[model samples]
Target chain A: MPKIVAFACEHSAYEAATAALERKTGTAVSGENPRFPIVEVEILKVPCTGRVEVIDILKALEGGAGIVVLLGCFEEACHYLTGNVRAKKRVGYVRRIIQDIGLEENRVQFFSLAPDMDARFSGIIEELSKQVVNMGPGPVTRIRDQTTKEQAQAAQAR
Target chain B: MIVAEQKPVAEILRMIEGYRKILVVGCGTCVTVCMAGGEKEAGILASLIRMAWAREGRLGPLIDVSETTVERQCEWEFLQEISEKVAASDAVLSMGCGAGVQAMARMFEGKVILPALNTKFIGMPERQGLWTELCAGCGDCVLDRTGGICPIARCSKSLLNGPCGGSQNGKCEVSKDIDCAWQLIFDRMKSLGRLEALGAMLPPKDWSKNRDGGPRKVVREDMLL
Candidate 1:
């Protein structure tokens, strides 16, 4: 199964994700609360989506995260105006970079959310998990192992 | 400054096909200003190469990629500063102008140097993010006679006595977007009260000083320390 990394904004997606967790077990989404875990879903909370950069996404993919998703606030709803827009642009750039490097573009995605939209946040995670399962493991790890094997075979041939 | 554009990634990959360990070097001067090749671009290219090679399922060999940037790639001092890096790597992928690439090749002797950018021309920015050619380095400048406008670079034909009957509505016949060089000269000369300059017949250009002179060089013994 593919590992998925989701960079969620504190003001929006983080809250929504916490709310979704609260729906499963009667608990408040707060610093004192221990959240519920969705299978293969790793949440990285950032102050804002704007804080997330192209390098961060690229590094995640290189580090064996099969899928990288950015969860930000909707439209003009960003507390820091244009934060989501900036994140969206960066996501597009990273998507293009990965695509150029022979990775599937769909491996990187951006979704906008509201603070209270628990259902939508859960739905996005479920959808991404399904997509990751379909995509299988990323190519980086496979390539590393393949190269080691080839080198061994070449040495034996000599 | 010289303006350049990066070559296609496929061509770059092809150029370094046999090389396993590579140094992807960037220039901080002309190529960077032109957005063709810079430190950031160097990192991107290196990452792309590694990613692409990895995706190929390690068909050939283990590709080891490293990156660095010099203040100017055309200068011997700057090139020498990264001599150790160059010596460590099997080949160099230079993210610099053609001249810079040649300079490194000359300094490094037998080291394989590959150019990542195609040097376009000597130009200046027309606006933010928009660059326009302003000179052709023809070795003979006539801007003094043409009211600071370059006929050699602007005119499609490079005619000494121009307008050539191809100018329409003050625009060059080649493209409506381009202003006729002669028309611009005439207007500027008239405005500057130097209309008589246009009447002066220009002599045949001396091509000896241009590229026709094989591998041009300048030597100033007096300036030698």
Candidate 2:
């Protein structure tokens, strides 16, 4: 299955995502279908979404993640004052870089929500899953694997 | 400090499309302070370049990117440390100002040094994330007479004598956002009790001291000797 890397803020999205995960796990423990098993997401907790750098987003895609998401607090409600604001600007900047690189601008995404919005978190995951299903396998992984194979082949020939 | 902004990624990508290996060299001085070309920015640019090419898959050979920074690219000693990196790559993507890029180009002599920044101006930060120009570097001093306000840089017309008729509501004729330099000069001088100094009409500015001459240089005989 394709992978999705979501950088979630501990202050907001992380807690909400945790709640959603716990709810899903409980339903599965009761012998019912685990709905979230379909969407493969690796949630990395960050102190603040503002701490997310532009290079990190590119690195995630380079590391085989199908898509990258930045989840943070709402506008004017960031615990560190302007962390969310800065995160938004960084998202826009990264989007421009990837767009210029000929990739879909939607490859990178940003969202804002409170800590208690578990349902919203679930919706975001479902949306990403649908996106990847339509997009198919990411070209980044194929290109990277091909580059590695070519380098190895050149070494053997040498 | 000198201010600059990064060029669009598309333009930068176009310039390096032919090169198999590229080195992004950043300056640690003015460009870093202005948030245009710094160590972090260099990393961002390198990553973008790498990924862009990797996604291309068949644009040509895979382009590899490396990043490094110098204390000051304008000086020779600082640039010496990156000699090995410079030799390893076909093109050097300089994230420094005009002088830094030219210095690298001269030092390497054979390699291509591409500029990644558009040098903006000599200015100071007016507020958080905001920088405003304060000097024109006209090779002449006029601040002592205008109560320290620079009419050459602040005024749209670079007026030497009095406020022009275009000044309205304490703003310049260029735009409402720009404050009138004469208004600021008058207010500052009035508060300093130096308004009487304006009674004398000043002579016309000497254009020879400005950029009228081709490429001016300074020499220090005592230090050189």
Candidate 3:
């Protein structure tokens, strides 16, 4: 299963992902949140979605994440007033960049949901993991245990 | 301020191919205000190029990328900060305007400095997320007669006399969104009780003072001392 990294805003998506995990595991883990037990989802908590930038998303791809998901508050209900909106624009920009690079533009995804929407959160993770697995291996450099350059060199050697 | 736009990502990637060490330099003045070539922009472009090539499965020990932004690229004093980096890199993907690119060229002879921005025009922010051209740098000054508006910059015809026959409802023939510069001039002059000035037949503009004069220079002997 391909691991998908979601930049979950603390105000919303993180809470919802926590809720989903709590419902599944019956307890919350301290510190770093591990990958979803059922699906390969790495939930990286952020202060707000608006803080997510074009470079962040692109770097995630370069760092070996199969697909990057940006989860923020609803467009009009952004905790920072326009953080979610800014995240949306960055997501759009990354999509265009990916499209221009002749890759699957959908690798970068954006979603708006509240903290209580655990069911939706679980569904998105499962769906994304399944989607990436079906898409098979992408041209993205899988950093693995080696440096990104070394990984790319291995890929080149292939 | 001078407004500029970044060239396409693909085109930029194409420009830096085969170069071992690439330096992405951004200008902190006008291009920064316009969100084109600035420190933040330079970092973003560097990361972008790194990822794009990595995705292509061709990134190895061959190509390395670095980025820096100066306070102003057109000034030699500010450019001295990045002199060593410029000398070491195979190519510089400059995020500055055309002048900045040329300045780099003149300052560091034989170094390859590639332009990453298409220097658009002298413009000001129309609103929060919009910009509009405001000047053309014409050697002649006529704003005193045209009620503080430049017909050459705003009008499609660059007419000095008045609005062309195509102007209607204070809008230019080129587009409805564009206000006719002559209409604006007339209205401004009329409000200032200077409408009589427009009736006077002005002679033809001196074309030699413009770009037709070839590469021009402003030698201020007083300032040289």
Candidate 4:
């Protein structure tokens, strides 16, 4: 199972995803299962992408997330004027830092969208999920496994 | 206020790599107003380091992470207030100015103290998010003679005379971004009907009184209550 963490803006990305899911369920007749693969993602909701701090993004990666995505408002459309703009710069900063630490910068990303763009939201999620799957697990997960193994060995010795 | 910019995250992480428990300190004065090494920045940096350590599975070396913002890190009382916090941690990461870092090191004595900001200069905000250097604290202020502007601090050449002849369109020839300090001085003197003061050749500035004399100090015998 692939693990991806996405910080979804309450005003745009989160709303769009909710709306898309509702429409999918609404169109399905009784007892007909939705064909879309339910991707395993931990969605963190933020009032605005601007509120998503640089540390929050890094924490997601540290918490065994193979991929981290920031979904916010489209350019020139943020309700908070420069919310999306600020988020973009912070994401860029985090991306450069992670790259410097020997991690793939592509593991972290940002996408802008509108509240009504449900199809686009789902498309982005699917594309990111596929990309993460191809990239395999992140360094954080490997480190966790190594630490756990060492701890277990030490316990056995004790 | 003194302006500062955070050292890159990678460099900061590398600095505190070996420490198990760290206390992140912040200055609430100059750093706060400049949007640099303040309480908010301290929390952000602490969180980033913890996350990075956890990611690398170096959890053993980053057990306890604490943060505190003092009223002024450069002051002894403020450092004294967080003495217990500093003692509890293996190291201290100070989000204060250069002076604050040394103050902490002086007070703490033996702890590993790291600086999180590169203290830029004594400056004021030119706009909402822009800072411009305005003072050199030459120990001899000449603002009265130069229309409240310090040519020692602003002029590219620090010329005691008028414009260096390189000034063009009121901008410094060195960079279009910087205003010609001498031009500003001339304009101000002209408006104040004090251009005649410009002709009074000022004597050479005393070098021993400035930074060239080494670490400056102030002893207030009257304030010793």
Q: Pick the candidate with the highest lDDT.
A: 2
Q: In candidate 2, how many clashes are counted?
A: 0
The CA-based lDDT of model 2 is what? Answer: 0.84
Docking class of 1: acceptable
Candidate 1 vs 3: which has more TM-score: 3
Error of 2 at B195 (Å): 1.9
Model 4: pairs clashing at backbone N, Cα or C within 3 Å: none
Compute each candidate's TM-score over C-alphas.
0.79, 0.89, 0.88, 0.86
Question: Candidate 2 or 4, higher TM-score?
Answer: 2
lDDT of 1 at B69: 93
Off by over 4 Å in 1: A5-57, A69-100, A110-122, A145-158, B59-62, B169-171, B176-179, B183-196
Greater DockQ among 1 and 4 belongs to 1
Per-residue lDDT tens digits of candidate 2, residues A104-158?
7777899998998877887877787778767644556768677788989999999
| Best candidate according to TM-score | 2
Model 4 misses residue A112 by how many Å? Answer: 1.4
Candidate 1, residues A66-108, lDDT tens digits: the string is 7889999999989899989999988887787677666889889
Summarize candidate 3's per-residue lDDT along A1-158 as a digit string, tens digits. Answer: 46577999998988988887778732132322233444355678999998987778877776667789998899778888999988998898888877777668888999998988877877777677777776644455443333656668999999
Write the residue-wise lDDT of candidate 2 on B1-225 in tens digits: 988899999899899877888999999999999888999899889878877776778424545688999999999999999999999999999999999999999999999999999998888888877888888878887999999999998888898888999999899888999999999999999999999997768787787888989777889988896
Supply the global lDDT for candidate 4: 0.82
* TM-score of the second chain for every model: 0.94, 0.93, 0.95, 0.95
Evaluate every candidate with DockQ and list the scores: 0.37, 0.58, 0.46, 0.36
Whole-model lDDT per candidate:
0.82, 0.84, 0.82, 0.82
lDDT of 1 at B74: 94
- Per-residue lDDT for B183 in model 1? 93
